[model samples]
Target: MYGPLPARDPVFSRPLQPRVHPAGAGGRLRQFRHDAFDRGMSPLLVVDHVQSAGPEMEPLPHAGLSVATLLFEHAQGEIESVDSAGARHCIRPGDLHWTLAGRGVVRQARARGESLSLDALQILVNSPSDLKQQPPASFHLAAAKVPLIALPGSRLRLLAGQLGAVRSPLVLPQPLLILDGRVDAGATVALPLPAGWNAWVYALSGELALEADGAGTRALPATTAVTAGAHLADVQLRIRGVGTRSHLVVVAGAAINEPLVQHGPFVMNTRQEVMRVVQDYEAGRLGRL
Candidate 1:
């Protein structure tokens, strides 16, 4: 077991950087990625916040990367998603959509006419050498199916990985834990981190104080993310809601130290491999919707 480190100051405290991109017809995407803090947390590449919606969202294809998209906010409506594996699924708000782009696959996700808001977090976890050649796959976990733990003035939603004896049905090749926590003012919660995993906490709303391993607690404001160093292990976090109701997302994963190269949507170990992925996508290898 790893021992906790002293409470330290926040590695960073700032707002999310804004980005504009096109999605489908009549629909644009407002996305944010915390790239300046990308450390060698192997298997994990980028974390993105996306809000995309309109009257309708057309099908868009992506390739060469696996993604776990967690939808936290959305209007009452349905989402139609299809893959080259002939798999089709309908998703609702407060659901999670996971796609392993292995070698490659074509994917299309669109709002079912009734939805006008689609807000989500798209997590990019890099596939290692052995798993990168596998066929593409996807999984969905509806909102109703997600487990929620209630405490005094607080609630926790276990999104992925394990929380005590409760494990998420969505399995990944790599070990990761994703949880959403909410606490009313003055409420405190403690969550233990598994040994040998690097952790991160992103405050979504309100304000909170996070203390780990007896270290000094630090303030976390909205849109702010703190990355606990890869070397820090066996630490348990004590979180307190300071102002109003605080909401946060917790992500933990084993430290990955592999060489990484990324180009657009392709994540590989070398630039040559990224070029190959580009050629394959242009050649229609990933397939069409």
Candidate 2:
């Protein structure tokens, strides 16, 4: 087989209670539920949609999956949801918002300013039918609370992963790791792919040289693609850039692999029976024991 792997970036190797990705190396980017979706075991939808500064978005729906939003900036915005612990909430930069669409909660995003700018990450996590019995939960973390780690040659923000001593709040149902890394000019950063998970890299800004499966190195220009290795274990992402290279990388693996039937935010095994959910709601199943 292959020789023992090399050492990983020390900045990420030591940590406490952090959500580490399932192991392996790097892999190809395969569309999950749709062509536009990212390759997460759970259905992933990444969009760069343009929004008017003060425009309010339409009510969005989530039934069988977990929904989370991370705002970059653009101060004027609100997210309202009836089924959430906080029925209505506002969206602001460094805001870590998560909503469980149990019972199919609805929400809208209202942006302020003159056609305000919006940048956020919305994740859809797969949940089996049994979990649907649980009502939704919501949380908002200040932009400042997100863990930011600075290495000798690069900088990193642990949005959903652990970087050294920093940790994130958005707990994932699956074994997943999400990271945002910025490589300084002429700096090099190495990411150690877990032992059994798949890896995909998305270039958001700048350019860098990368080595995969030890097949030499190649330059990854901006807006490049995610690659799945011929073998699931050939997943390592190394970066070397004269200028800063900004990236968003997601590493994930197989789900619980159970039945994931869902309808209007209710995740259950059978679509035919929605009455229990109704009766439970009427009786405040979530509200009561």
Candidate 3:
């Protein structure tokens, strides 16, 4: 059992109404960008919901950061990803891929065929200051390996981190929790959140309402995101599906609260460190995919 939400807890709700950006060649890929840092949601830097139709390939370069990609059930076809470390993976629907870009890493992903499509969320997490300089690593969690919790009218998938006794097999760079939740119409699900941790909830589809103990309920429509927590008391987020079935994601992590210097994909503690990472990548020291 968790305690009531603190009176001082700040809750924020915002719709995902950002301008759409074109990615990949010929505008085959569309992306909705959400910057958590700019919105005062720390630990999480960016959350991008990307959709692609037809063949597309994109090069990703990173250092001193962590990334997680979650694919939806409706996602079609497969994606082939190759990294500078000679690691390759085939990503399909309902799969979760986590990457730790410690020192530096170059990764490229492409649609396997023209007939396939993609709908997924690409999340960027800030690495701890101490582990930012380590070697790069990656982890893959197949759809079958993900843990699921079923309720009366709701099903929750633990994509990463822990929920009660349920835990994900994949190891993350920091303590974080990622949940994919589906709720039938009129169903309600209560999500327990650790004290002092920040939480972001994004509604993927359907109409929903989010209610905290002390904070009043807030409407959550499709493509909208809500953030809460960083309080001294434990909290539980109650999500109620309205009108139709609802699909959403819940991500929570303790705030890093450290200074961040970012240059494109490179994230470091200071400008000098970011410059060094950029130099290494430009000099071919980070390797090529």
Worst window of 10 by summed lDDT in candidate 3: 29-38
Clashing pairs in 1: 6-215, 7-215, 7-216, 42-256
Candidate 2 lDDT, 151-250, residue by residue in tens: 7877666767554456687575444566666776777766665544444454545776666554555565655534332234435656676465555444
Compared with the true structure, what per-residue lDDT tens digits does model 1 show for residues 117-167? 666676777777655677888878888878887889898888788877788
Measured by TM-score, the strongest candidate is: 3
Q: Scored by CA lDDT, what does every candidate get?
A: 0.69, 0.50, 0.79
Q: What are the models' TM-scores?
A: 0.83, 0.64, 0.90
Those runs of model 1 whose alpha carbons end farther than 4 Å from true positions after fitting are 1-34, 38-42, 55-64, 214-216, 230-232
Better of 2 and 3 by lDDT: 3
lDDT of 3 by residue, 1-289 (tens): 9998655335544445434676544333323343522245567777877777636456778998887778887888777777887878888889988888898999887777556667888888888898799998888989999999998899999988988788998787688888998999889988787776788888888988888877768788887777777467788888889999989888889877788898889999999999999889989999986
Model 1 lDDT, full chain set:
0.69
Q: How many collisions per candidate?
A: 4, 24, 0
Q: For model 2, what is the error of residue 257's alpha carbon versus the real structure, in angstroms, after optimal superposition?
A: 3.2
